[model samples]
Target: MHLSFKNLFFTIASVFGIFAILILAKPVLIPLAFAFLVAFILFPVCQKFEAWGANKIFAAFLSMLSLFLIIAGGLFLFSTQIIDLSENLTEFKEKILEIFTDLTLFINQNFSFVPELERGELLEKIKSGLSNSVGTLVGQTFSGTAAFFTGLITSIVFTFLILIYRDGLVNALVQFFPENHQDKAHKMFKSVQQVGQQYLFGMFIIVLVLGFTNSIGLLIIGIDNPFLFGFLAAILAIIPYAGTLIGAAIPVLYAFMSYDSLWMPISIALFFWVVQFFESNLLTPKIVGGNLKVNAFTSILSIIVGASVWGVAGMILFLPFSAMLKVVCQEYIELKPLALLIGEKNYTDSEKDDKPGLLKKWGEKIKGWF
Candidate 1:
């Protein structure tokens, strides 16, 4: 029962090697992961249909169809609005420039000993920078759009197949382990599914509420293109704090540019602040219900890391992935310490007792092996 150094080294290397592969394969895997996530989100609806006497295949098909239609309709509606907004960009830029000029003049008029550059030169530089930035942004947008459509098509096809043959996939995975471990494997799979489903459904509801509430508020504040801004905000809300901050900037900037009065932008900023306060304090808690036990700090850190590794897809996928990892660690005795480290204290009282501290357990194992 002696543990060899060679064996330990091999184990560590293997883990690292797998991680490397995952990083390298991220581009290919992103669509598949997205498909699985979408399927996971739709699982409850499929289950409800099944409960209502429909077969699994039929239920899945109906759910997918409904999702497709909703997405298509939203895209169609938004496309027209986006085109109109793009067409008015010249006017928007002019308004923004006027505001900038006014601010510059105010600063020069009010402040003493401030050396002022020629307004025309400054404006020209700003315009040149903005033009370059816009061109770069447009190029990136075209590339991103192409990538998104490609991923979307692949995800849709894969999701349909996955939903259709989900049972077979489970069975195949179960077959990978020994006969005695099949039950454990099944249990683990169930835990993953439960955590994923709960997270996805809860997040969906929360994001929808956020979008609608913000949209309504913006409309009330007389913001142009409220629906577009609100929708973007809601979608960005999926990324946690960063999403809200970025989402707020759009309307705030629009308010500042669209109106001559500073009061309007100030009011809009206040409105966004209130909406965000409500989301964090009220909506998130009521909807998500503390199932995701990661604290705010860890949640943000995980999102930043995930987004870095996987781009936007990473950010969206990271939350549920972390949740699933926590669930697995809680279920497996050897990995319990990891669960404790990743999860909030409120979510893991039983796990604390059931799973020993990681270092202690590892030390004992090493000693026993020797």
Candidate 2:
């Protein structure tokens, strides 16, 4: 058989062209992606309601309402804690500065041989840079907030429409292809939905567990604002490894500054380490399992790239998006290799045993054919 260079080039170009479109249309695509994510997450609830004799439109409305209520309740509960934190910002800043000064003095005393390590100048430079960065960030935030609200309104409308006519949309998409391919398209859509639903539900449980554990642990460790820290931890937990460490810093620093003894901060750190240990070994394996099984390295790399591309929203959405991408590729014969790279190793003994035997069988078959 002859290789079709023309077909190969067209395929490669089409793939790159789509990627280019995604990047170019990111302003629009980001909100659409977020709407899809919200719709995917609430799909199971809608399904259950539908099964319970509610119509699709009514079920979708109820689900969306439930989602809104949950969000609003959380915001109300956390509002006071956030306000308290903001009010104490000056105190936190002073405490941070004092700690920095002490650290600078200690470093100067211990590392006097390093003449270029002038703590005062370094501190001044850092302060100036931080101030400038903060000013720029605030300006960007104001502009971004306006855009975010606009997007939120649009996404809500889009989600409502999607839920109301999800079946119709699916039918239209399936019909776009040939009749023979329609079944395949429908199967692929179902697979994607199943994977997305499982991942979102599992992640929601994981986040709640982590949040509650963190809250209780911080309170036990004598952190003043346990709830706020817990909430922070929960939000951060969405991003995997990086979120946990970053979330831990709030309570640890609070403990360090508020308490006279270092033991408080030390205890807080130890508590988080223990909780994380349990989460990784017990909770995650049990709750999340091996489904949507992305590799740890890929998770981290995706997070970094996602954060760069779409900020916090990107980081939160990237995992499942990547998982869905993997599922799509896994369904295609030509892209299975890419899926394997992103996926976890098959550790089942049967699969492991079959690997070498399959290789030998293939070799023998090739020899016989020759």
Q: What is the C-alpha lDDT of each candidate?
A: 0.78, 0.78
Q: Distance (Å) between predicted and true CA of 208, model 2?
A: 1.4
lDDT at position 300, candidate 1: 82
Residue lDDT tens for model 1, 1-370:
9989998999899988866876899867888888888988777677677778888789888989889899899889789778977987889988888669667867887783357656677678778888889988999999999988988899888888888788899999999989999999998987788667667767777778877888898888787788888888888888777888888888788777777888878887898899889878766655555545466666887788778778777887877788788888887788898787777764445544333333324334643332
lDDT accuracy of residue 265 in candidate 1: 80
Residue pairs clashing in model 2 are: none
TM-score of 1: 0.79
Model 2 TM: 0.81
Tens-place lDDT per residue, model 2, 1-370, is: 9999999999999978976786787777887887887898787678778888999889999999999999899889989988988898898887787678668768877888556666667667767877889989999999989988988887898788888888888899889889888999899887887667667777777788888888887887767778889878877877777788888887888877778999999998888898889987677656655556577877888788778777777787788888888888887899898887777654333343223222234334643332
For model 1, what is the error of residue 302's alpha carbon versus the real structure, in angstroms, after optimal superposition?
Answer: 1.1
- Mark the 10 consecutive residues where model 1 has the least summed lDDT: 353-362
lDDT score, candidate 2, position 22: 67
